[model samples]
Target: MAERTILVAGTYDTKSEELGYIVEVIRAQGGDVVSMDVSVLGDPPGRVDVGKHAVAAAGGSSIAEAVARGDENSAMQIMARGAAAVALDLYRSGRIHGVIVLGGTMGTDLALDLCAALPVGVPKYVVSTVAFSPLLPPDRLAPDIQMILWAGGLYGLNPVCRASLSQAAGAVLGAARAVEAPVSGRPLIGMTSFGKTVLRYMVTLKPALEARGFDLAVFHATGMGGRAFDALAAQGAFAAVMDFAPQEVSNHLFGGLSAGADRMTGAGRAGVPQIVAPGCYDLVDFVGWQGVPRRLEGRPTHAHNRLLSSAMLDAGERREVARAICAKMAGVRGSVAFVLPSQGCNEWDRPGAELHDAEGLAAFCDEMRAACPANVALHEIDAHINDATFCDTVLRLFDGWLADGTLTRV
Candidate 1:
């Protein structure tokens, strides 16, 4: 019987021999090997489908043509684009168990894109000459994005390469055998939070959720952090969503602050019980007074730190925000509701605070009432979402939904 396939990737033209050697190592470690010939010049040392050709649609050039052009810059871009097609194919075919790649900056760029296409958990090792720097890719291209660094591009570094190859082979096999069971618990409940806004979700909402036998995963509502929360929510990982930061909505509606996901509210769809609170919808967050964009230079701004400011939201943007909220509310699978902190949303948005603005607040609330589906309970709680008393009442409502499957606000 044949063994499983391990994808070996690289600029096969430049590093064919090394790739072949690595392939040999992979096979010896009890795996069949497939090669993605991401080369620009020479032929791969082993059986390989030309990378440029496979990736042709992505880069609009044949591998041979890319090689003939002899432009490293163009070739690298072509290779990166092409790699996407090849990796996608490999993944769909289920022919790839693990992947190992080697490259310089161009090669690395191309391969990382391919790596990014893989699932969240996979054994992916990069034997690169540029691993010394701390410049890991931003998107976490591969779950296991390790590298073998050296001055000699994947070629001259034989000893280190051999060690990494052996280790990588074992690592891949071990990963397949020892797949980590997902954290055991309820569907993931996304908890949105900022340092200042954590009390509502953590102190108030989280315990309440657990009391109802729910397992919660909290997400700090930093720039991209909210998306991370939403991602988990969308995956059906969370049975419920406790969104306590409506302030992130400010960032989503207007270029205001480090808010939630770009499409922050999309996760409130079918498959989860969500209690949405616009906890921070009242203000726009910016980087300090100076970091405020020129167009926003004169807006009411509260300096929160050397690099942070909360600019008050405008009635115009708030109108759009109300629409956004209504759309999300209308799509809720279970009962979906929005809570309004009557006194304030964020710490700075309270009366006499820097973000105080009655006009903008009314516009948002009124719009919400007008646009939101009648099924969505709209509450203008007399107290803030984080106040202990407010939390108790909110949880009482949330618990009823969790237990009886009832929808609507008290």
Candidate 2:
């Protein structure tokens, strides 16, 4: 394999020794290194491949202008923008195969922006004091970035921090060398669903779609999974999308486990044709360990595991969720087909099930029928979402789209 080049980025003015150590480790592993300095006030004792002046300039501001702001946050923001631009340029030019950044809170803040600038599948790692902390919001994180705790290295390099830093350096280099970056080989279809316990359409749809000459990538519709699905969809990664498990949409609206605000709108904005269904429409998942909120105290609840619990929505809330879903699909550039399984949306909500609520399901279906915009084609199926008939209905629409040239083949 060819020698990989890794970008070592951080506030080099303060952490020059530590950053230099990371570079040395990468070089020792037979990998090349490109150093970037994001310092505002001081300069690194050694020169960097990309200096603070160039980084600040790339962000549309000079270091002098950033210093004039007289605030660390403002100055760092400028560096963050410039660093992201420079790093992305390096990746696009095939100069850097992967990136590993070192920082505390301030460095981590900038690291997030820098990593986000790179495309998914490129190796991005952050060795930070705040690694895996709640200080980092889910929305700001790059879909595939990895983080390692910068343990015991808050002030300076030590044996403890060296262990973490060296491992991070090696991991990024190894990942860049081994990664099979996403390639456009077959026509890819992106689908979202829960496991077979709750939703089973993918089991039937996967083999059937493959038989028809397409590859399907199924995304678990939890928080981070939906985020990844949306990220890939926004990149126009799929020929078409099967957005069947959009419970995250309701989760976002009602303060459950959210996959960020821009959950179901990616494929639409990118003009990728999509077929959507509310696979677990009637239930909102919340952190299972927390006490149930006062507003949802009396609703029927089902504990899926130690980490996740679902609460049934009432008839009124169900209608609200239906309206929310319709609102998101109203102005899409691509074609949208909404499949509403009228009998039930999940196994927990079927006849004699723990979350069975006939009245709520009927309300949601009715609201969906009334609220669906002219741009969206609504298909209301009589079967449950987990049933074979529901999968058949989706396949029929998908086949028709492929035949009519609504979806391009690979």
Candidate 2 residue-wise lDDT, 70-180, digit = tens: 999999999999999999999999999999999999999999999988988899999999999989998889888999999999888899999999999999999999998
lDDT of the structure predicted as candidate 2: 0.92
Top candidate on lDDT is: 2
lDDT (C-alpha, whole model) for all candidates: 0.65, 0.92
Stretches off by above 4 angstroms in model 2 are none
lDDT of 1 by residue, 231-305 (tens): 556655566677776566666566654434334454655456677777666666766745877656677876656
